[model samples]
Target: MNKRIFLSAPHMGGNELNYIQEAFDANYIAPVGRNIDEFEKQIKEYTGAKYALAVSSGTAAIHLALRVLGIKDGDEVMASTFTFIGSVAPILYERCTPFFIDSDTASWNLDPNLLEEELSQRAATGKKQPKALIVTHLYGQCADIVRIQNICEHYGVHLIEDAAESLGATLNAQHTGTFGKLGIYSFNGNKIITTSGGGMLVSDDEALLSYARHLSTQARDDAPHYEHNEYGYNYRMSNITAGIGRGQMEVLSERIKRRREIFNLYQKELNIIEGLSFMPELPSSVGNRWLTTILLPVHLSPEKIRVTLEKENIESRPLWKPMHAQPLFRDAKGCINGTSDTFFKKGICLPSSSSMNNDDIQRILSLLKPLLNC
Candidate 1:
């Protein structure tokens, strides 16, 4: 049997070992260490953010962001139903309601029009204002931030960007994670880069970053002995993991370039197939193409091609099951645009690992062409 191709797997740069060695040599194995500081610094510098806090996972970052924004029970947070569950789960964690919005066809992120409708309706109910807007940049594609931000501001809501899969993506040269009041980046195993298991919360607000850092580390108050003024969580990233993040940062640009190259190759090879359309980047957006996706025509389902790829040991997946469609979130209030449902039925995520070479591309194409009847 051949090596199974993954949709997206971690690619490491050689510099990782040096950072790990430094961690060991310095005996800074705990979550708080020079490595963690350096990693946070690097993220801030790279993303042009004023502050950052490393965390255990992207979900934790979202939770912390919500907590910092003071999202409490009964507060309604506006979020995209077309995104991964992780992006909206934290709202539920806080016992807040998620007022879901559908995606715009262009970015596959939240639709500003639907957002306005929801907000206006919610306001008409004479209830509390939506606390925050959680928008995801799905598959490294930037959301229509200029419009989304405008809507958020108009509604007096906080903007939190779930940029876990889009660390290197940009819009007019501004990085994805920097577009909101708070944003998150994941360093999971299948992401463009990995800290093995870690994430970061970024923001321009110094106080929010400081509060996130405090809350992540158990919210210990200033004192000589163990102390706490408020609730806390064990969400800080370990030094070892941050070491890996530091190393991954060194090759971030290269990985983004490789990802885009793979997308180009797939687009060039597969675009000719009938009823198949490659997901495109917005003209003003620079996407990393975290996972190359295709929108299959209605007659031909994406699941069929996914099954075909799986049979050949080449992994493929359908696009994220819209949060609203999930049984867990079925009760959540959401406005309909049909775009997310349309994407769910037709979109397929293809093998898009940065490590994939020309030969790998040929193998994937071989499998896909036959299924596509091309």
Candidate 2:
């Protein structure tokens, strides 16, 4: 048996323990501490956001963002159908009705054309439009955000970027998350960087973020005694986790570099194979390449390939099943095109951990080449 390879796994910088030790030394073990403050500051600086609030998870950040935006029962919220449930679950948490949009063939993110169609139809019917549009930067790739932003603005809808898998991604040298009203990042164990489990909500609007921070910490009114003015959630990131994020932030650029290198390596090696195509990279966007994904010809079974890789102790996974197809969202209204369904059927996520060296990459290729007949 060989060492198991993961599709995406935590890659820690050597300095994580130093920050953890500092947290211990300062006795900042709770969610509120210098580490938390510093982590939020670093995220703001990195993403060019005016404010950031660290929370327990990316889903929590989304929930807080929706709550701060005043989403309520029966309010419509539009989200990309081609994303993890984390991006859509928050809408339901806010008691908002979800309207899903399909993906563009090129960027594999939300399709702005479909978005316009949906919004235009809603406007024509004189019905209330979605309160917000949650655009996900899936697989670290930036969506056509400039176009999407224009559509959202035209429709008078707030945009929230789900940048969970795209922390270091940028478009025309601008960060992906900053173009929207609010954006969120994840630092889960399997993300580009990890804080074990944490997320950050960022925005240029300080008042909104201040309210979000208050709400995340149980929405207590300013008083010495325990008091609450409204509904709140225990969603703050703990100091210990923030310490991990602080150290991970120090090495984020390098991690992005390595991940991209991994993507390039995989493409260079496997793309020559018949029936295989790598995910397209847009010229204007620099993606974090969090996971190297490929599309196989219809004849090749992605599940079979995944099983073969698993047998070799290498972890591979099918691309996210479009949310519209999920049993949980079966009844959710969606503007449909066949793009996302096709992607779901043929795409596979390859091992792309930044810790993997060239040899590790070669090992994976060697195992796959025969199976793929490259």
**Using lDDT as the measure, which candidate wins?**
2
Find the candidate with the highest TM-score and give its number: 2
Position 73, candidate 1: lDDT: 95
Clashes of each: 0, 0
What is the overall TM-score of model 2 with all chains considered together? Answer: 0.98
Clashing pairs in 1: none
What is the Å distance of residue 333 in model 2 from its true position?
Answer: 0.8
Name the regions of candidate 2 deviating beyond 4 angstroms: none
Q: How well does each candidate superpose onto the true structure, as a TM-score?
A: 0.97, 0.98
Worst 10 residues of 1 by lDDT: 273-282
Candidate 2: C-alpha lDDT: 0.92
Runs off by more than 4 Å, candidate 1: 121-127
